[model samples]
Target: MKEILPRQIESLMNILGTIPGIGAKTAERISFHIITSKDNMVQKLIDVLYDIKENIKICSECGMISDTDPCHICLSPERNREILCVVEKPTDVITIEKTGEYNGLYHVLWGVISPLEGIGPSDINISKLIERIRNLGIKEVFFALDPDSEGETTMAFIASKLRDIEGLNITTIARGIPLGGNIEYSDMYTLSRAIRFRTRLNDNL
Candidate 1:
């Protein structure tokens, strides 16, 4: 087919298509929408992106992306400080929070351990998690990682490390989530059930 789209529009479509779940057709539509809109949406988007880039800060304690060092959850006195929920990313934290099933503090690993991908325990936030649990005197720690192989591996590894901690309970979310499902994509009811019926890792491992 002859080149119908302008060079800049084509480039924009290509860039947008690179985003996950966005196909070429969807990217083309979005690009046309951006270029044709008269509400100065593009400029507003640019401004928001720039503001996010400049102002976003990772939580020093939990590795969550927020505007504060410790993040609101970490600073919230209403949360259960004795219990910590370990998740893969900051988005996972948000997902669990929406369910209202967990009111404990969170520790975002940022990513899970994937040996195939050359990501080990050190690459993510495991060390800090261990230290945080000990320092905070956490009594129970439950993993909310995805149900994939990597998520399992990461959870098992962290559970083993915490084994030596005296009187600490290590658990994983129940199998309410499908074998390969992601925590972030799970329905609120399912995720709530998973957390509510979490099983002790010691019993399985």
Candidate 2:
């Protein structure tokens, strides 16, 4: 068969296919749509991409991506200072925020500990969390990591490390989140219930 798509469009599709969930067919369709769409629409997308790259900054306190260093959540006086919610990624922070059941501070770990993958406690954002809990006088630490073996192992490891922290409580969201399910992909209702019914990490471990 004769070559259907131009080399440039093929290259674009290949680039798009690199995205996590975008398959080759979807990438090809998106490439075609981008080429066929209005020039201003394409320009707008390009501008927005540039804007994101230039304006987005990682929050120093919570590790969430935002336009500011500390992020609005970290700066907000209304948030509960005595509790902190720890999650595996910034997207999980956004997902939990949508549930509106939590008003505490957050700490994004960026990734979970996976021995097979060579990720360990030192590899993710653990030290800062420990420092925050101790220095900030946070009374409770709520974990909202993905419900999987890696998540469980990570939580247990962190809990063990935090055992020396006097007068501190460690907890995790309820099991309403299905096993192997991701907090970022969970429904708001399930996440809400999970937060509302959270249990002590010691009890589950």
Candidate 3:
């Protein structure tokens, strides 16, 4: 059958709809706007879309996205190297950073242990974390993972695995974040309070 709308327009809308927050109607609107926009704007978008893959890379030290080996935070002398904050995703690091409550180094796990999903420690960046803790003089480690089963498991796994480290304090953020909620979706105030009131993992949980 012949298509009612232009084939190219339909194709553009289909692709746009694949983006996480964009729905069908929003994708349609975006496609129309992009088509009507200045060629320079479209070309600029295209350039960056292509450039991100080449320019962006995972930080070798912290597993965060960066153009440098040890991201800016890891390299910065201003941050407290004695404490390390471990989070599930790179976005969580941003969420916690916005709170301004933590002034320490960060380690992005990149993922969690989801058994049904077949994702285990080997799949995530846990080995890198151990190496960092061993090499760096981090006195305390904070777990800022989500409240789901996967998050709990991941946090426990890390803590137990690092038990051999001497003089290390492993703790977790308080229950300010509701169950089933992730750090990325939490508000600034709640996240800040959680960080401020953090406690040892085994003591409270």
Candidate 4:
């Protein structure tokens, strides 16, 4: 059958389809919307995309994506200096932030250590985390990573490094999150329970 849309419109649809969770049908609708919409709409989208590419950067201190150097969260003086919460990604930080149960600062690991994937302890942002803990006089750190094997391995590795820091405490959410589950998907209540009933990790780690 001959294509209903022009080459340009079909190209747009194909591009949109590549986005995760936006399948062919949805991409078709979106492509149709964009092409039929005013030229200003397309122009605005192009401008924003370019702006995102030009302006967004990773926060040097926390590894969170931001438009500024340190990011607003790190610059804020009200955040708790004594406690830090380590998460696997920037999205997980947002998930935990939604619970309104924690006042501590955050660190985004960017990725976990997966031997099969060739990701190691040095690959992610661990050195910066150690530097932060040592410089900030942090008392405790909470690990809010996922419940999968990779998460466990990452936690175990991080715990080992923190042990050398005398007088510092390491902890993780107790039991609310399910095995193989991700913190990004867990509800706020469950996350709150996990944070509230967190357990301490020691030499047994």
Candidate 2 structure lDDT: 0.89
Whole-model Cα lDDT per candidate? 0.91, 0.89, 0.88, 0.88
TM-score of each: 0.93, 0.93, 0.91, 0.90
Runs in model 2 lying further than 4 Å from the true structure: 1-4, 203-205
Maximum-lDDT candidate: 1
The TM-score ranking, best first, is 1, 2, 3, 4
- Runs of candidate 1 with Cα error greater than 4 angstroms are 1-7
Q: How badly does each model clash, as a count of residue pairs?
A: 0, 0, 0, 0
lDDT tens per residue, model 3, 81-146 = 999999888899888999999999999988999999999999999999988998997899999988
Off by over 4 Å in 4: 1-7
- lDDT tens string, model 1, 1-205? 2198789889998999999999988998899899999999899989999999998999999999998878999999999999999999989988998998899999999999999999999999999999999999999998999989999899989988888889998888996899999888889999999999998887676
Query: What tens digits encode model 4's per-residue C-alpha lDDT throughout 1-205?
Result: 1186788888888899999899999999897787678777888899999999999999999898899989988998999979999999999988888899898899999999899899999999999998998898999988898878888899998888778788888888778999988888898899999999888877557
Q: What is the total number of backbone clashes in candidate 4?
A: 0
lDDT for 64 (candidate 2): 91
RMSD of 4: 2.1
Q: Least accurate stretch of 10 residues (summed lDDT) in model 2?
A: 1-10
Candidate 2 local lDDT, 107-199, one digit each (tens): 999999999999998999999888888888999999999889999999998888888888788899986898888788888898999999998
Pairs in steric clash, model 1:
none
